[model samples]
Target: MFCVDALDVAAELALPAYFFFASAASDFAIFLNMPYLYPGLPSFKDMGDTLVHSPGMRSVRAVDMPLSVQDKELDMTKTRMYQFKRIAEGRGVLVNSFDWLEPTALKALADGVCVPGRPTPRLKEIAHGLESSGHRFLWVVRSPPADPADVFQPRSEPDLDALLPEGFMERTRDRGMVLKMWAPQAEVLRHAATGAFVTHCGWNSTLEAVTAGVPMICYPMYAEQALNKVFMVEEMKIAVPLEGYEKRMVKAEEIEAKVRLAMETEEGRKLRETLATARKMASDAVGDGGSSEVAFAEFLRDLEKSSMENGGCNN
Candidate 1:
């Protein structure tokens, strides 16, 4: 049977399972019992006096973290209980990351954790083909809506191309395609002509880029994206941060410069090498004898056995 939530699946089967810890390890470290693996994380001292200093998170105000987790007026006992139940029934958890990316933190999580390998593809043909064809491309990003917008614009709107930066339309007229929202991400990444990714560094996007052997120009806007940027550019050596923004609003010039650097610099070349290596590792992890694939198989087996023992039959 298909399970939407891993926690729910484990609880339903009453079997030992684990979750792959993703996102900022710092966030996970904030809980009372959990230990933070990353020691080099920035201190909240810069945030000012009002923020509470915790192991994983530091906040000047109580509202900074999720309302459900922050010590607030609302009773979160029920929510917490539900979350605990999910984890308690899990045998082990797997994170969608590599050891080199966050060695200390991954080690900490690995203390009593199981890291299933990342499932990545090696598209050598696509890469070679893209190299042969000289094309510059940009990625348009979108995420599922957390809140409704006042104006809804369709993907095919006629004036869509004009709303972008001046000369962008003309410059990319021959080489670009503007996707309104939600293009097939994996396929796009694996395509032959994708030269660079302009990404927000969401864990999935970051992992996808690594898996596809692509370098990135990071534009982190919110949440753990900033943290991911740290690992991607500084730790993993596969990306470069876009600079020259006053209030986080990146101008066209900054984008162009960073993109050019990503495409042409020695740093970019090294990043490409790193990405290629990461892609190989991810592929190994998902291959028949790979760690992630093997773990996934065991998880399925245990689940099935538990279900049968519990008089639950799969239809």
Candidate 2:
């Protein structure tokens, strides 16, 4: 499932291939059908407030579709379309979600619905937001890429004194800690002291927070994260959107408000309570007779049957 580009290799070798889709099932449905849905449209960025209907999900705003599939003319979009086409040619598609976690989406799949980066803000905003929120924090800082072309480029350690607001560290020193570049994210999420995550909504991170029973403050940076934000905040009810995140510049006030909402209010408590239950459900999903367990068994059975029919070839 990790190898979308390897399907051709499998075909040449007479081996069956499967795509283990790493994102939500809802997004999978959209991808499988993109070749048909996006032939002659204006770019999604130009389709403000227009709703797009997919077989697996309620209508999603066109602008909210995954960025890779949003523009029809770009090479990346064309590449994604080609990938989707390859995915359709595979023997089967598997998703990371369980039925209980995404019932509506999973149901549509059973019904054959589809059959298939961070900008530094001005770092001052976050510095001020954490300070103003009066909450203890652990922030991992990295230098912003010098230009758009360097977006995926790895950066050197940040110059905190130059990038952060003057006196910001001193003011927050007693309550906050900042680490350079990367930290042990899974370890942090699993820590008991960790209250909520301020995240980019990457699927792996989202799953980590969910498994840890932690709630989130969504601040999607790129790719399909914006759609994940929509699902988490609007459908899963497990996160609160960080306002102004979509604009790529969030104000300190907005951050403060969100931090307080997720940390100090009754609403925050409810979010925590909800996550506790979700954590248990997530655990159950992979346990004996649970939704994911049963679905996986069914997949294996099908794989074996297909392999046998193909005369002992691994499918």
User: Which candidate's lDDT is highest?
Assistant: 2
Alpha-carbon error at 18 in model 1, in Å? 5.4
lDDT of 1 at 28: 41
lDDT of 2 by residue, 128-240 (tens): 99899999999999999978444688788999999899998888889999999999999999999999899989888998899899999988877788888877887888999
Candidates' C-alpha lDDT: 0.54, 0.81
Q: List the residue pairs that clash in candidate 2.
A: 1-20
Candidate 1 at 254: error in angstroms? 2.5
- The local lDDT score (0 to 100) that residue 245 gets in candidate 1 is 24
Provide the global lDDT of candidate 1 against the true structure.
0.54
